[model samples]
Target: MSQPLSVPESHPPPALIVVMGVSGSGKSTVGAGIAKAISRPFIDGDDLHPKSNVEKMSKGHPLTDQDRFPWLAIIRSTAERVCAEQAQSGEVNKGDRPAAVVVCSSLKKIYRDILRGQHPASTKMPPEDDTQERHPSGAHIPATAALKTYFIFLDGTEKVILDRMSARKGHFMKAGMLQSQLATLESPEGEEGVARVDIDATPDEVVAAARKAVKDMIGM
Candidate 1:
């Protein structure tokens, strides 16, 4: 049998870890691996992209900021909702619900800002008490710190990325579009609560690096 992730001496606080990278950087693979390592639920952010966005990407066109705003909003909302649900259910989990992992290509810093609830330009912050806001399950949810986001960037060279992309199939993101994705990516360095790791390693090895980065950030 394969070995389980070794628990650190100190358990970390719950967090929303967004696995960020270009299309071929293995965001989904490493993201799921880290979720398993952390014993948390996994959410593929691509799954939440609007059909319009999907259609655009399928045609190999790069998404403009306008094209991305609505989609980013949805991803932010979904991440927040997951964190809210986990926060409410944490006690019931008896400390078992550590966190949630989001597999996303949060390419730019502005995009990442949107993911973390930084209001877009010309937008006002919502009022503290949003009476209209309630969980879909009809539960009263308090204001959430659930928007807290940390990025785990799966770094890779263009050659490696193109090779990986070339070997994959049945995806809307064509290997031809990799350069556009890489061009759109913003370096996560010096950003609050971000970790970057090279993906030029085995899947488990990549996950281990990601796990340690997450552990360090959350103080595991």
Candidate 2:
């Protein structure tokens, strides 16, 4: 009889990173590149959305709050599982380094709120946005030792992002939808545990800036 191999009891925590922006802002492309550079797994938020949601988006219809509820739930579950897995494991293995990056259009404060709520105790002090009032309760659950939850806001001029979207094809989100996305977008500032980087720069430059910004925000 073959002997059964014993699996390790624990592993390292995964980073619960949300690569967010409106359509045409390069969330998926930049997220994949960042995941590769960091040697972590990347989960495109598009893939997590239900077929109905995709259909709605493809039809140029914007998703309502209802449409996003279940989708965001899945994201939360995945993040929770990754964190639990790491907690069970003593230390993070190179193989286990959190590679889970979710590329989604986390456009509004409400949308970001759902993701941030996963770790209730992790919200830093509220930023000084007189226009914004809803602040999450506490610090979010730590995703990995390297990060609790890292948010990357891909900021770019409307013309630039619109132009890039116009050139891309086959994606469900069309360039025509860019205006709506822009209308819905909420800018990230300090105290949201987010690192904002301009997308007007080259991809390498953007990525470098993103990394530096994230590290600076989290002290990682």
TM-score (all chains, Cα) for each model: 0.74, 0.68
- On residues 1-220, what C-alpha lDDT tens digit does candidate 1 reach at each position? 1111221223334466899998778888888888787777798876665666677899999877877765665566655556545656552254443467898788888888877766477433232222123223212222234446789989999887776666678655655578777777778888998998998887778889998998898753
Q: Per-residue CA lDDT of candidate 2, range 148-216, in tens?
A: 566899988788886666667865565557777788787766646788878987778887777676557
Q: After aligning candidate 1 to the native by TM-score, how far in Å is the CA of 27 from where it should be?
A: 0.6
Error of 1 at 80 (Å): 1.8
Q: In model 2, where is the ten-residue run with the lowest total lDDT? A: 130-139
Q: What residue pairs clash in candidate 1, if any at all? A: none
lDDT of 2: 0.61
Among these predictions, the greatest TM-score belongs to 1
Q: Measured by TM-score, how close is model 2 to the native structure?
A: 0.68
